[model samples]
Target: MGESDLIHLDVVGLNPAIVKHEKQEKAEFSINRKCYSHLKKKTFATFVASKRISSLWHCCDEAFSDSLSIHRHVSNVHANEVDMLISAALDQMSNQSEADDSVQTSLNECQAKDASSWMPDISHLSEDKFSEGPGEVILYYRYCQIKEPRLIRDWQNELCSRLHLTGKVRVATEGINGTVGGTKTATSLYIKAMMAHPIFQVMQVEDFKTSDGGADCFPDLKVGVYKEIVPMGVDPDVISYKLAGTHLEPDEFHKEVQSLLNDGSSDSDTILLDCRNFYESKIGQFKNCLAPDIRKFSYFPDYVEKNLDLFRNKKVLMYCTGGIRCERGSAYLRSKNVCKEVYQLKGGIHKYLEKFPDGFYRGKLFVFDERYSISFNDDIISDCRYCGTPWDQYQLCSTDFCYQLVLSCTACRQKGLTACCPLCQVKGQTSSRSPTSGRVHKEECECTNSRPRIPTDTS
Candidate 1:
């Protein structure tokens, strides 16, 4: 590319005033060891200052391909100018009340050459110093009204791109739900940018459940307009947040669980219902909770209908992964007036684990990502489908066209864990089954049909 083409101002948004500032006499700008830490706080002043510094480096990148080369060029030729520009940016930022005092002090102490040198080698700061290591992950959702979902989706895409984040975000008239991952810095910038948006003005920054991981959690960024953040398959107008169940704090939930256990009433007045899909509950759940055996969330309403008698005169406590599902699920139940009272885990199991890790919930938390599952405790609740050993590690069936996932122990897998279920195994052995039609016939595994054979433990 030509120099002019490569140095296009679109990426820089560079103003003539910035060039004028660069021409001024050099002032020392120290690279503070703690500068990256302060950048993560999400204060407006810090965000703006970081954006400016990022822009300055972005412009510098346009002039040179290799960061080391740019560091050398700036150190030898434009060290003073770059320092002056940074000083000007820092000076402007220092006037803002939200800017960290340490940030300004660090910039002032940095020697231009040394500072330029360090900026190019930022990848080295990947240790414990940062709250989020290089590739951290997060799951956040907001149940709020959106006037323009398409516009919000477009804006979200640009924001995620700018921050080098990848994940899926679904926006609708009802709200938004997403689980995304990136380097700690990228995800931090994304949260800052998202909070600044007017559409998400009411969103509580603390509501986001940030976990340690990397961008590999999601394959790519996918933002789109959806009907609901958590699909309950109901009209949005029928239910609202005001009608949702009471939210119990983590400690409160723990206390309540203790009370329930103490009551020792076989005919309990309260119910702890797991609102997640059957597969999710198969791996992990709270002790003594009533986890429905439904295949998908869509069956939840029907489940409630069939079990209306169970909810009568009872205080029901419902929960899901991140709380969004329970938000609507509880609302739907409350609207029916079948239960005496309804409540849900404030932030769901994710938040509950934050306060009380390995307390009540057990086994691995099955996540819809490349990581598949995360452990809360060493307790393995489920047994290997093949060997019947105490194992919770789940994997897709070895059958190419079958999408069923089952718990297969290492020993079982080694012993030729082939089909998802016994029915599939029998079908796989027959030449009549086509590879494309390897999916087990749902009817064959249903209650009406013969139950799928559970492999007897051979070991």
Candidate 2:
């Protein structure tokens, strides 16, 4: 490989650019961090810039060798002066805007955000027989740290290649983070491979766990090279992350959860708090877990602070996706002198899923991959708010203006019920003629308050 083969454009200061990539095996991005976070916001931006000729150049000779192809591909990219990068930037802005909007809307209203994360359409995937699923492990992990950007990228590729996993990999100067999924043995073997093998030993992996239902939990694997591992994008000053905490096994932790729920016990002042985003909890959680209404992981610190007074004298049991949030959250809470004893679910919900496939937990498991959601049993968690029956499936509204995705079973779906529910019809419709006109408030439309509260965290 020549000097030109080290092809990475300095995106540190670029306003934002279209970044088109991904073939059959990759996930293409039109705009990267530099452009998307700073510039436009829309659902999908159309391709504005044309591809420059230089991008089409092939550096490899006719020799069909793998090594040569890799090296030559690098060279071609480095020397690429094509305007494709600019075009990619514009397209990304549109996609980002849509994603951002969808996420924010989903947060407050309890609805599905962008459909991008859905692997195939949810309706389609639900019908297929996932025989290789069930007990198969289905999750991934990404740890971030400061390193040479190019080195990190190489390490990511090596990590996936060595594990023989299929997904994406990205490397940036700030740090690296990604998600990859496979089967039970494959996932475990990959972890062991990363830890013991010296071939790609630079990568440090944190343990990830989920239950038997993980198969349908996440959609698919997604890897993106970001300037920061977890996308805080914060300067080193305001907050510096330190992943330090004591590790607890399943036996020791489950006892604590049990003690908290049982009354008249010596472990009286204990709090079971969940530290995950709202959607994950909607799927599955501990029976008595205290699900916090948080929209994003980054906001955990604030929730901890606000709720500190609630559990000041009590033992605080905190948890999240992996043990990532709790490791940091416990330390933060401890520092504040709020809780008497701070404990986090050792490996979060994933570990629980692995240990107790059909254990105490009840309901589906929500993940951040292509599989929208997975149920521990065959049944769904929450029902259509109006119907008051079991229903875990989600569907986007046909009405363009009411572009919301929420829980709806086949029965409710068949009714052509889009916005208002049966209950809403009762309270909303004083008279059939002008029913939806008066007395039916927006709050009446959303029955989340009345529906049995689902766990509100990923873990």
Best by lDDT: 1
Worst 10 residues of 2 by lDDT: 41-50
TM per prediction: 0.67, 0.53
- lDDT of all the models against the reference? 0.65, 0.48
Tens-digit lDDT string for candidate 1 (390-441): 8887787665545667678888778776566776666556624555544434
Q: Pairing residues by index, what is the TM-score of model 1?
A: 0.67
Quote the positional error of residue 29 for candidate 2 in Å. 42
Regions of model 2 farther than 4 Å from truth: 1-146, 154-177, 182-193, 196-221, 231-244, 264-268, 377-381, 395-405, 418-459
Best by TM-score: 1
Per-model RMSD to reference:
17.1, 18.9
